[model samples]
Target chain A: MSLRIPSVLVSLVALGALAATPLAAEPKSRFKVGWSIYVGWMPWGYAADTGIVDRWAEKYGIAIEVTQFNDYIESINQYTAGAYDAVTLTNMDGLSIPAAGGVDTTAVIVGDFSAGNDAVILKDSTSLAEIAGRNVNLVEFSVSHYLLARALDSVGLSERDVRVINTADPDMAAAFQTRDVTAMVTWNPIVSEIAAMPGANLVFDSSDIPGEIIDLMVANTAVLADNPDFGKALAGIWYETAALMVADTPEGAAARAAMGAASGTDQAGYEAQLAATRLFADPAEAVAFTLSPDLGTTMDHIRTFLFDKGLLGAGAPSADVIGIELPGGAVMGDPANVKFRFDATYMQLAADGAL
Target chain B: MRLINRHPGRAARLFLGSLPFLILVVAYLVASAARLADNPGDKLLPALSSFAQAIETMALTPDRRTGAYLLWSDTWASLTRLWAGLGIATAITLVMGLAIGVLPVMRALLAPVVAFASMVPPLALLPILFIALGLGETSKIALIVIGVTPFLIRDLSLAAAALPREMIVKAETLSASTWLIALRVVLPQVMPRLLDSLRLQLGPAFLFLIAAEAISADSGLGYRIFLVRRYLSMDIIFPYVAWITLLAVAMDLGLGGLRRLMFPWWGLEGRR
Candidate 1:
């Protein structure tokens, strides 16, 4: 008996067509927010765990789910794939992963930046200039690589002067103890651990280059545009928890300790990580930072590094490929094809007690 | 005859072997084309032309950063680790397998321990290895060795122990010492089995090598795939995966050819 191949092909084509057909316009009922472990982004987990997220979401008449991902990159990828309405990621990654992948994304919350959180450590050395002629172990192509590039440039050196061994983040701590590992670049907790070891010294860190490695909660641009309540709900949840986490009170300490324990650290350890991070807990400050000219220059440097590394879309001709829209309608890159935007509207609302 | 056991002639064998792979490639091309037609900038499934362009840049072009071709360097780094791991594991297993196979005392001491160790997942021990071995090449090579050595020892020892008792007795009757029996009689008989065990292990060895490299290496096939994975550069990733698979197949073929050439009497019944 011969199977009807033409009929089968027609059925497959029909299924594809059905998938392509858009649904009738309706108000979205549910939203998902993706987050991973980071000192600044920990408030997302805390809000979700303590029903703070649920309260805000109910007020906005929407169901919001907060999901935690183990791998940081995977969470961004999922967000780019439209699996989540919002995802907590760094600014460069928000640009590189989703915006670069052709997904329209907007930073709803400018949470924080690494102050002294990420660092370069050298064995028996006290200066960044001594890092030359050494093998630096770090996760290649990560924010650490960006930090290393900036570190090297400051010392009037380049990557050619040293070797970059692409060690995994998990291995960075252990790799530092080995005799061959004279120099390395990595972020908090590991930096804390390795710096305590004998003969290890912090040469340079993110504190020198503030506002560059920014953490953000970016949402799908279309989702925020259609459901402004989602934006309001997200901002309210963040600032409420941020207030609790930052207050010098017993309740605040309990809130912070819970966040710390959730992220595999204690209250003191988490507070140390928080110290290294410049968390914009005050709504007005975060909005001010978003509107600052420093944000513009920071993005300019990041785009240059990303474009040079081919992190921007492959077809990109120059650093001006993806247009990043800042506050006050000022545009960066090809303005006609803008995909990434920094909107502090909801943050302003939170600051004015209007949410 | 059952359809499963039906024999195919040479021409038929070639066509039959390639049919499934051909179908898979065609399906992928169609799916990729459909996705691209919808969104030309899709990185999840890049077009065929983009793959060609990616390979040209990776293989033919010298990298602007370090002035080295990435593909060749990655292959060299990964293969060097693989060979070192496989070589050390083979040497250690040969010595230990012979001991455990011939002497009950050695068997009682090691066999149970090895069998238990193999049950423990090698991936779980990865963090400990990095900590104890200090995240250099020593740890990577050690992972590959630890992952494969237990099985190799078990297989080779079984082959040695199953040898006919008459062979050892005849050698003993000729006033041969225990060392002489082990060297002349047992060693020669077990050589072909060692080749067979090594051939079967090529896949798992590559797996462990890639895992180790992914965790900690500056240059390797796995490292390149994973590093670019952060940017969702599937164009580079697809080609690298195919290249690694080709290298593995070549190594498997080379091992089979060596076995046939070195021991003419081995697997003489068929090339199965």
Candidate 2:
């Protein structure tokens, strides 16, 4: 009956003297990617600014659109609800939302791990040990929270020894300035602003614990399965963009400035922010970062930290939740084969000057 | 003399004032041991000290030097957005209330819908409004209309219903038209009630305005709070909140004065 209706409509339309049309090219495969206004995810804004996103999308016969979010949590929330094809998220939120919600999602590319970006800012003369019993402001259960927890472990203190105030990110700098907070866990430019305040000092940062503040491009498990080629194309484009960023060129500077502007910072400010984030200049390095043997031990610490903080729900999540696997061949999760393959196969082709 | 006349409420005032002192004393005693053992001051004290320092640095710094738009921009931007939204809402309420209130059948049909709408929290509609209207002034105006029109409808209905039966009867006996009776009798009766209703909704409209402006807005007082929150700028947040509160209070006073001036016969309940 449905088939008959379309045929009848086609015949009726044909009678109306409109062109008995030749079939049209398929509509562009428009995909929306969401990212928060963070320095780590500057590449997303840069790709959009440099026209690399659209160029790559056109090459793959797809149209790519990017949406920048003000709040990291809301971006993850929107991503979890399948509002976007992919989203840039911290390793923790990536786990809490898409991973925990039973959505088979894969972290395709590792962007940059925080080095000195996430910091424990304090006022007056104080060591990390001296921060005991002080109220530390941070968005609870976020990567900065983990950074704070890790900072405490280095000083032989527990996060429990200090009061944790559930302050949002945008307010952290002001909190530090107000001196109402003894300490706060946050990222730049707020970090830079607070560090500039007289009597303010950075007690610790992600640089103190490398490879902890991981950023990734996460794809929905189902969409990835249906369009593996699009995944490969995205991986190619992301690495290409990263390569351009690290190289010395006018385009790179312009792209960096655009990212800085989007983040409400200047070129120098943006470069300063980038200096603190350990960006993978090459996709092979990113791939290596993903598969390190320490990934297990560190993620165990992360998972345990999350479970203790009540960010992870119910049971303890297994280490396999990270889902690290080689690209092309191996499939981990069922049906969609959720792959965290930061494999440089496509990126290597994009680099060495090949697409 | 007024103080003596209001002396019966003195016990409540004293209790309220003493409550903070009692809390402080208990808190201090508990923190004294920590202060002695750790040689650290109380958290609130440090928080306040830092806040004062931040205020002196940021708020005191000239706008040109600090690149701040100044506190005045917040007041002006927020007030302009709210006035525009309120203007649209008032238009909607006036039209809908007039149409629905005069006809008893229309009033009966809409009473349940308006009552149900009135029960809905305005903030809850923000996301749906955003989706439908795309996070612009339109959404804010739509929400304000949805938030306020129901009260106006209800008030106008009651005012129309309370019209003296003798006036209607005499109008009918004199072979007066419905339109003539409505303009001459029903409107004058409803005018005072409408003013009261508008005044009552002013506070709620302001509340929803601030909340809506807080979410996804780039400018306005609420946005100022959110923007400053990223830096934990509680000093700025608190001042902006206080400013909005003052604006709301002033609007209430102004509306009350206007109500008294416009409707001389209405007592404090309506005049306010």
State each model's C-alpha RMSD to the native.
5.5, 21.4
What pairs collide in candidate 1? none
Docking category of candidate 2: incorrect
What is residue A117's positional error in candidate 2, in angstroms? 0.5
What would the TM-scores of all predictions be?
Answer: 0.91, 0.53
Off by more than 4 A, model 1:
A1-27, B1-19, B268-272
TM-score (C-alpha) between model 2 and the true structure: 0.53
lDDT of each: 0.85, 0.66
lDDT of 1 by residue, B162-233 (tens): 999998899889999988888888887788888878878888887787787777778888788778878778
For candidate 1, the docking band is: acceptable
**What fraction of the native alpha-carbon contacts across the interface, defined at 8 angstroms, is recovered by model 1?**
0.45
Residue-by-residue lDDT tens digits, candidate 2, A1-355: 1122234234323322211221111232767688888887878877887688888888888778888887675566555544577899876666655565444567767788888988987778568888899877776667888888888888899866987655545545544554255677888888898888889889888899998778878877566666665676677678877877777899788778877888898888989999999998687677666666665556567766755643332232543443434354443323242323334444455445455
